[model samples]
Target: MITSRLMVLRRAVCVSWLSSCVRKQNYCSSAKKTRVREALTSLDSGSSIRIQGWVRSVRLQKNNLFLHVSDGSSLHPLQVVASSDLNTRGLTFGCAVDITGSLEKSPSHKQRVELQAQKIEVVGECNPVDFPFKIKGHHSLEYIRQFPHLRCRTNVFSSLLRIRSEATAAIHNFFRDNDFVQIHTPVITSNDCEGAGELFQVEPAGNEHSLDEENPHFFSVPSYLTVSGQLHLEVMAGAFPAVYTFGPTFRAENSQSRRHLAEFYMVEAEISFIQSLEELMKVMEELFKASTEHLLSHCAEDVELFHKYNSPAHREQVNLMLKRSFNVISYTEAIEILNHSSEQFTFKPEWGCDLQTEHEKFLVKHCGNVPVFVTDYPYDLKPFYARDNEDQPRHTAAAVDLLVPSVGELCGGSLREERLELLKTRLARTGLDSTYAWYLQLREFGSVPHGGFGMGFERYLQCVLGVDNIKDTIPFARFSHSCPL
Candidate 1:
């Protein structure tokens, strides 16, 4: 009987040990939890929750300590309140911390709810002196640009990231909804799409000296970082009725203007069986309107931050852009408007010359600061692939450029030269017939009159946000004589 009692005691001890282990495991699992965004939205009062994020601000009061924490989910940070009795060690601006707290109604009007902390654990410590962002009132976009690595921690850059992500999603959705297949185009190519002589040559590693030797270069013939994806989209359009590509493009031009970037993104779309420039312009207009609408609806708060801090004029521009349809005018009419303008232009408006930024800005203003599509540019000003208009007085191409306020040209597109004879003749004149034989084959097999356009992604952001520089729109700014990480 005594031995039986002892066995029962041992079994009871084993059960207790197992229960203890389970409790510890549960505690450990629940410790590293809760996003600041979710914590801010909690409606259950007096519920214990754990939140983790980088501390945006810390305010110590006589009885309580308040911290503004953010996990990048929203533009605004969550308010975390801890009692003076709680350990506040290692909690500072930019320091990552995990706090176990209770949900409570906020006394202040800034936020709906705040965290009443019972425990605070420092996940990572940051030195306030070494941190570049010291929680200032308002930082200029130019000043924050100096610290690319840590700029995302700020409110403005973080908002831009959110806007960019939403805009990308909206672009994909617009294409998908309209039955346009997203095609991945090759970044390296043998022919320059623009034929501008601004190609960045790509050579094989350890063979830098053999560029001119002609001893089996990296690609047999020379290859370059693609300046545009229009040709590839053109190729795909032949197969698929509608195709588009959004990817990085490179240029070797030494332009240092606010609107220029050596490496940037382009959104190109090609539609087969297109008859006139009107059809292509319709697609471009719909795309711009749809994407901008999506951004304004979804990222209203984040986009407003750009207007409030960056440029107050941006608010009116955005409202106008949304309220009205884009304006359309012929290239000839645009030039005439510029020529008739009272304001003196640095580059005089001429018949055959390319429209400079000054001219584009003037045209946009003349149209009451609305986005304008100027169609039928001079044939000589466009590339060899642009379809010839074959007009009476002036030779022009079936090309169009979308110009916006603040930014000169946001998009450029043309109806492709699909006639085999016309394409061959143009290529022969440009001396690119042999190099672009494959392009000719597409016309030979199944020729359909098609057109496409390329929109500079950075310039689009600048136009929508009224940002002054193209660099501020992109995550990493790359330009002439400047490449910073």
Candidate 2:
């Protein structure tokens, strides 16, 4: 009935707007705010265009002043050539300027076309001495990390930002195309989805009232910033056949490792009625490949910038990762391979122990460094939610971890324990039966076999771009003790 009503409503709306919704121009129709990249890409000679962007470089010739301006649309900046007769007032590197110009074919071989500016107005000025970045030469990613607020002005970071935006859209598109419902999962909740005890506590501001027993707590039972949305996606999957959530997830681990972050974006999804791990793995593989292909097609120039300048070694790895099928191995097999390896790992290879970064890297290396999935982990290592593999010789959970080249564990997931009594027993053993009683109710009322997976958004970006640190992928680096704006 609900779906029928939705269909009727959609039809009604469509019918009502047929006459009113005449086709409109596809692109932005603006005379004042022309994007620098678009203006450069669609250069029409003798056309007057007003463009605004931050100055990337300035070269003052005897007869002309040439400036490369960028508005973050592309890796390459728009070349604006202004004669000395024009007002070049307050023009400097990092200054935001609006230029009214006539587009013309470039006389020089460097650029296809250049903007011949008739007027130049500096909207915002930056003092060269105080500016953190130089007008010329590439700055190291670490050096730019210091100025998180202004690093977007840099070519490398700007390209990264573009890739991130495009990748996000591509991911959403893939899910939408695959008939998955997008869920806006809560950021704050009472339960720890991962049960890792690494949640960031969410509390009100400090005051005397906060200490009062009568109204002491914000949310009576100690609310926390969610560490994962997997559990919530699982809830939605009960109603919707397929559900996914992409949002910020918090963790309070204090490690200062390059991979650790206090907060990061996660893409999590839950699917109902998945019979086997193979079905779940197929969706994972498709999601990764489709979204990556979209990025390669849509953000070609931005990706090229990373290959040409940022991380040259990743160029071939990325191609192979996308072109070929991902390899798979059982956790037992991975352990055997690790044990027989010549390289001594920091963490010893053992049957029941969790795989560390070194161990995961070795497993990926064993498969020739393309993405690989390791399945059937020790039951004890997995969470209470994982489905039990009773048929296996040793106690194992139907859990899988997708490991990529640079980033060890790119994604983790499992077939959930849909059996009511089994879930109850597992939760009881973990002392979370009462806490997740509502979660158990889904199994009791009506539950089918279900499973889901979660990927760290930053980690995926790091792996794709060959970024050494997780901090570089995000707009702002948030770590154990650092939260710079």
Best by TM-score: 2
RMSD of model 2, in Å?
8.3
Worst 10 residues of 1 by lDDT: 1-10
lDDT of 1 at 208: 50
- Each model's C-alpha lDDT? 0.82, 0.82
272-344 per-residue lDDT for model 2 (tens digits) = 9997999999999998989888898888877877877788868799889998899999999999999998989
| Candidate 1 structure quality by residue, lDDT tens digits, 232-346 | 8888987999999999999997998899999999999999999899999999988998999999988888898888878886988877877888899988998889888898988
**Candidate 2: stretches off by over 4 Å:** 1-44, 208-215
Instruction: Work out the TM-score per prediction.
Output: 0.89, 0.91
Worst 10 residues of 2 by lDDT: 1-10
Off by over 4 Å in 1: 1-43, 207-214
Model 1 Cα RMSD, 1 decimal: 9.9
lDDT of 2 at 341: 88
